[model samples]
Target: MPLYWHLLKAVPSLQIIAHRIVWSALLVAGWLLWKYGRGWLRQTLAIPRAGWMLALSGTLIAFNWGLYIWAVNAGHVVETSLGYFINPLLNVVLGVAVLHERLNRVQWTAVAIASGGVLWLTANYGSFPWIALALAASFGSYGLIRKLVAVPPVRGLGVESLYLVLPALALLLWGESHGDGGFVAHGAVPAWGWGAAALLVFGGVLTALPLIGFADAVRRIPFSLVGLLQYIAPTLQLLCGVLVLGEAFDRDRAIGFAFIWVALAIYAVDGLLRNRAAPALPG
Candidate 1:
């Protein structure tokens, strides 16, 4: 978030997103080529319904990335943190609704508590918490879609990057033509300097690695369990917003967040107890 805020000081969010997509496509392409040879693309393409599903997931993740970058740069890091905090519960809901995953009573209770927290925040928030809701919904849906699709992590991300790369390239080209590009300048003078340009390139690796890891994890674990673990990210994001970035965290917001945290704790404790009680598998 800090890196995005710094980069967006000199570059438009859309342009930054374009750079992310284009560079990520290059990185993923190279990885796919090296790891699976040239056959990976053909093999992925042969999967039933993979293309369209990945297309939808790609679009969703692009929107989520763009919104997060713009929100961070717009001095709404706290709200963005709230968005990610809410995402895990949303994932739990999605797991039950879309995947037909059954949740124990305690897990359901956690979801109810989280839902109440969101409602409380919305009702008293002075305005709709659209940023939080949108982020949670898009990302939760993205994870669900990725989980449903049969493609492997690297290849799924590769396909997603491929789907978005053309438009990203076009956006970059347009920005350059309009003298608003961040990576390169219209004249001799560079736009935003080479440092910013380098960061934009590095953004691809930052973007791709976590997503690949997430895709791999989502495939290996139950969707709701993945959601439970995701709190680690939002916890860090919240600290970054409140401590490092110095965003406001008043009483009302704190109360709402407290409710969500309590819910997460309940869900986590229930899972741990269930695991402890279950019989050990034969070694």
Candidate 2:
């Protein structure tokens, strides 16, 4: 989270996003080589029948990163915060609309409350929180892609990033050769200092870790629980943005957030009831 905040503070969102995707690709590639060997890599990279879906997912992920970084750097942390809060609800909606998944009465109520919150925020701000909405959509779409792909998280990430790495590397090379490279060249904190470049690797590892944890959780826990915990990331972002980073928080934003929370609570209750009611699979 701080990585994103710091990056946005230092560079353009597109540049930061490009670096993130490139680094993630590299890190996952290394992991693939080590864990499953070249055979696994070959299998992972094997062009599948659904290659277009993977490509589209990559594009959506890129959009999510770019917008998020922009929001962070632009000091709209509050709105960025709201976006993540609403993400799970958005996902549920996607499940209903796109996948034709059924939501019970409780789930429906949660959606209504969340909808009300969004409307309240829009009414107050005189515009919808586009950043948050975009993030939710992008993330939801990425999830949909992953669902369609049905690969292990690590391997899936490897494949997705691998698809992206080629163009990313080409761009980096082109930028450097043309004297437009984004990397800093030299100094204590020198432009592209050893430490700075090193952070990219660390960033990749850091980025993958939480996702891995989440994946594990997904396997071990219920989806509703996973949905609730998803808020942790954005909540951290929101807190850091305001309390730690000292971004301003006004009454309207507070009210909007309050409404969103209420909606989420309603949504969570809905999910909990549905999960409890769900017929258990054979043990």
Candidate 3:
């Protein structure tokens, strides 16, 4: 994200998003084609429900990507980290509300604590943390939609990319014509030069690789483990925002974050205990 914020020095967030979509679409499409041949596309297109779900998820994730890019560049990295910190708890809420799932008392308590933290942030942290809420909402909704849809991660991402690619390409072309594009132009190189262009292009790999790896990891490991591991991202993001990027983390915000952190600790411990108590199936 910090790298993205740095890139924003040369490229606008919209263009970065467009490049991310276009190049990711091409890469994912190529990989799908190579591995599954043309039949995969046919098989995927046959699933109308999945397609619609992916479309909605794609839009939500696109909004998330754009918002995150803008927020980081706008010096709201700490708040962005807060969004991701809030995401897992929001997922718990969504599971109950949207999926009609049950939560244990401990889980409920965690949710309550996180909610209190958010409210405290809003009440005392100067302004309503809309950026954090929006990020959490957009990403939480995206995750929920993806979970409900029966699609493999890579293929799902491929379809989502396809849904956005046309407009992304159009946007890039428009930018290039207007001499505002960051990657390349008709005859002139981008003023930011080749390094930024390389990063812009590499953004596709950066976007797809982690998601693919994460999906594979989920398949191979216990989901509870994945849940526990999810904290690493926001933790590092918070560190980056505070230590690396030099963002403000005053006492009021620290208190608010402390509430959320305590909530997460409770949630994680409960999950671990529950997972351990459950009977293991024959391998």
What TM-score would each prediction reach against the true structure?
0.95, 0.83, 0.90
Kindly list the per-residue Cα lDDT of model 3 for residues 259-281, writing each as its tens digit. 98888899889988988999999
Instruction: Note the Cα lDDT for every prediction shown.
Output: 0.86, 0.68, 0.79
Clashing pairs in 3: none
By TM-score, how accurate is candidate 2? Answer: 0.83
Highest lDDT against the true fold, candidate: 1
Clashes of each: 0, 5, 0
lDDT of 2 by residue, 104-184 (tens): 676677667767767777678646678888888788777656655655777767766777877777766665555444465
Cα deviation at 30, candidate 3, in Å, is 0.4
Off by over 4 Å in 2: 2-4, 45-48, 126-128, 175-192, 213-226, 269-283
Better of 1 and 2 by lDDT: 1
Q: Write one digit per residue (lDDT tens) for candidate 1, span 131-152.
A: 8889988998999999999999
C-alpha RMSD for every candidate: 1.9, 3.4, 2.7
**Cα deviation of 40 in candidate 3 (Å)?**
1.6
Candidate 3 global CA lDDT score = 0.79
Query: What's the ranking of the predictions by TM-score, best on top?
Result: 1, 3, 2
